[model samples]
Target chain A: MADIVLDKVSKSFPDGTVAVRDVDLEIADGEFVILVGPSGCGKSTTLNMIAGLEDISSGELRIDGERVNDRAPRDRDIAMVFQSYALYPNMTVRENMAFPLRLAKLDRATIEQKVAEAAKVLELTPLLDRKPANLSGGQRQRVAMGRAIVRSPKAFLMDEPLSNLDAKLRVQMRTVVSRLQKQLGTTTVYVTHDQTEAMTLGDRVVIMRGGAVQQIGPPQELYDHPANLFVAGFIGSPSMNFLHAAVEEERLRTAVGDVPLGDRLRRELAAEDAPRELILGIRPEHFEDAGLVDEQTRGRGTEFEAPVEIVESMGSDKYVYLTVSGERASAAELEELAADVGADGFGGGAANLVTRLSAESTVAEGENRRLWFNLEKIHLFDPSNGRNLTLHEGRAAGALAS
Target chain B: MAASDTTVAAKWRWGLLDVVVVVFALVPVLWIASLSFKTTGTLTDGNFVPREWTLDNYRTIFSTNQFVRALGNSIGIALIATAVAVVLGTMAAYAVARLDFPGKKALVGVSLLIAMFPQVSLVSPLFEIERSLGLFDTWPGLILPYITFSLPLAIYTLSAFFKQIPWDLEKAAKMDGATSGQAFRRVIAPLAAPGVFTTAILVFIFCWNDFLFAISLTSTERSRTVPVALSFFTGESQFEDPTGAICAAAVVITIPIILFVLFFQRRIVSGLTSGAVKG
Candidate 1:
């Protein structure tokens, strides 16, 4: 296993289009790091640069403390699992797995032993004699993984490897990949646009946008403490709702109601040159039905009544889409985030808030219901720069836990 | 019930068309076969079937030096031209399909222009150039033009097939520690074999069927192919008819083509239609 480091690496095409910017990343030995972003965000390009499949326009790439920027892909001693599986169509499963070993000129007995061991681990023993064209999508994916792991390369670079499988099979193979990575402990750099995979698979997730790094942290840390407006909107599903608010004396005033600032937020605002207008960011799950909360717990948060436009019950939780009477929060970062997620537009006119409520709560569609939002969990962002004003110091200290 | 009746009538009409097509294609071949089997006395008898059946025509052609030598020249030239054209075309087509280089479109455009160019227009010039270069009447003379003319066809068909292959396999090979040459030989070349075979068959047929180039270029029996040699055949003496021997020689040259098509019909169909649809 090896630790791979990208020291301010950047990739620009001959046509002067930058795919990856000056980004520095250090992946330790045996660590699984995920590079997650929307399409055209340079996640895959970064992975390709590390694999030496793509030339780095600037900066250096180091594998196991040796500079490998100028090395060929084969000379880098790394294996990659492509999104298409990329199994050799003409070769059987055994030969596919034995390819790297054969290229390395290993003896026949050793190559056979290694392929057998890998096939067993990947549950491909029964399929060793079958060509990839005869295999199902999931089987082909396992064969791809088998091909990568059989060589026991210094690191594994995977570019959205599970994206081609059906949803259920993808979930199943996700665990399989996780188990294999843990068992082998190979330094792995995985790239995907799916946030769920990034959350469930990586020791740390790096979020990128417009060919630049937005934030890098553990999934939970990024979810709880996003660095900017783009990261806040991109990290979570039923994405974090943003509402335009104006800073008042000790509270933030929005069309829904006044949200009183906590002591920490107040102090932070007082210390910095705060902007007059701010964007209040709240996750869907951070909201609860006011009626379901006990009086003691309800005292800790702010409550407001808004007309619910739609209610989708997902068995365990209720998603209440509410239309608050206010202008929607608009910023370049929010627009880019909306476009990235393929959203038509963020709050065409009035603010639309999606709140996750307990299923037991008696909330109905088209009814005004009281919703309580956790004030302490709320994130405040400056409207002009989109920088999260409420982010605390030392928040990313726990980002690199393996 | 009415729909079923219509379907039955439609099937009957389609069967009638099939019979017409079969007759249209096989009649000339049957006529040649009949002529080859006819005795010299019945050569102009105008009977569809031979009145006097004999194997003398086949025996006469086989026994002569002219027909046999021309047959050898035809086979040698066609095979060599097919081999060279397919190899060169495969390399060019693979580069066109997989690489991003300047003038790529221009290369494809030039090949396409060559494919569409009238062959008769180049015959006179090629004739003069071959004579000046001392390539006239030799195997290399015919082989050179054959390879040149068949290259565009070979390139168009092979490149279409190459484009159908996913480029990801090459990257996977490289990541697996195989060098670029190994990647091509081990991963790409095997996948492209059927396409190459289909192109070879096409190039061979083209070279084999070209009577113009063979007759225009060769001045002697040394390099005269079967098609050109067929025109020179008159029975053993000036008075005797050569139709029977010529028909027999035509049947001999066609047998290889028929066998090739019959054996590789499925691969040829797939190779031709590979890139017309997305997988």
Candidate 2:
């Protein structure tokens, strides 16, 4: 219903800690945008600034073409769903949903009609008279959602609304939220630390790191082409494997094998004045069981043999962890990404490569297997600056330029 | 069968301990009730139970205008003091628990220090100040001191309760189209009602049971409360004792305190803030 624009919005504490700095974003009318980042990465701070729950120390926030940086949350007419649900414990379900309407001074009959409508949509009509304490976690979450949607505010801001639910319930509610957002067609800005939620839910995802925006694009674009070392490591599950590759003339010598640089990469490296040592990035799905690949399809990529350390059967795909002898990829951005997930052993000197093969493949633990990695899908980053040296033209310039 | 035997023995052990505690607490109260029912001649019999029962002592206190006026003053002063103290305490406590400002810790520390201060030490100074302020021997005279002394306890108890309430509820209210004041009145105040009720009861008891200020500040029957009035009771004759009348009055005042605790006991529970947020 409203378009929200954050023009160079920044937040700083009195003690001189910058929580969010110069965050520039534009959310179109009825668009669902997600701010995804690791903990302490200022995503929540940016969301709070948009909600008017926290003040922006500088810059402007405008909704519907009017600046609302100094406005109160109620004045801004935006509803929020908190991670804790935050239902009024003293009120029954109907009362909780009717709270915003009541505060807006709506007449009794109109409030009743709106609440009944919202409860019906949320499938909470049967629980209209029950208090929050009596409801299950998912039901309470629905009630929280009901409260936000009941008022038909200008926009909706959700701060990890489904994080409290169980895994199966979280997935179920994710669909519910997606369907609801489309049905209501309200502009929503959701902040979460979950990349999966960001990938699946948002129309466009904004990836943040260390109080700065790393990239902004569609989920598939970020998955296929991460802008930098941080985005490359943070976006995918069983995240992209990083290996130390030293430039030797036109060939890059890696622990897996010597990777023959294609003409496009060699031209990009020359144009960017690439370093002698580079970080090679390959996603898990890009690597396949070389034996399972056909002769014609195997010609586009190279093969490397390594002893598999572990094989996890995930029903749809087999995740094979292979260990090779090499120095692990080292960069400040990579280290921060690893520390964010509390995975200290990630990118340790063992150079463990995680590859996803077809479930039908005969790869097993403790056996040396030949894996073919797609040459066309690999990314090369400069070791000194973490910039993608092989970045294609027409990508979002904000990340590459930074 | 062996499990049933041990369960029975455990119940018996608990029952015996409960009886011992009840006896220790209730014996003095029963003795006072017995004294109140005893006739004038048997007042000094040194018996736990009265030899003969009489309603004459209750009749005497009710028939007197002095006892009635003091009782009226006691109820009015205590109720007014409790109301004012609780209202002020709730606001102060909410600010202390939720807001960040200079001197927040100092305010909490000073309030606690006042609560720990001896009441007797301040009574003389308070009496002189009340007299000069032309508030002595009046309802405000007693109510003002009671509020001043009890506000610290009220603020402390209510603030501790306020800290347990999830702040997210207030933010949710604001996001639900409520102003800050509306958010507090609709969401926070209801969540804090139990604590307020509990603090009100405590402040009421403190004001009702106060004897030093009531005796030191009031010089006439116009504003004299029950506890001070109890000391002024006289028998029908010059040489007669007023023990029976005083005991009846004591029994009368104790009834209100018992009724208060019994009525608000359920509201003094601690888990009201639960279910407001995720466990």
Considering every candidate listed, which one attains the maximal DockQ? Answer: 2
TM-scores for chain A over all candidates: 0.95, 0.95
Q: Is the docking of candidate 2 incorrect, acceptable, medium or high quality?
A: medium
lDDT tens digits, residue span A98-169, model 2: 988988899999999999999999999999999999999999999999999998989999999989889999
Give candidate 1 regions above 4 Å deviation.
Answer: A248-250, A262-274, A394-402, B1-12, B236-241, B262-279
Residue B229 deviation, candidate 1, in Å? 1.0
Chain B TM-score (each prediction, in order)? 0.91, 0.94
Global lDDT scores for all candidate models: 0.88, 0.90
Q: Global CA lDDT of candidate 2, please?
A: 0.90
**lDDT per residue as tens, model 2, B1-279:** 999999999999999999999999999888889999999999889998888999999999999998999999998999999999999999999999999999999999998898899989998888889989999999999998898889999999999889889999999988988888898898999899899999989999999999999999999989999999999999999899998999999999998888888888877776666566677
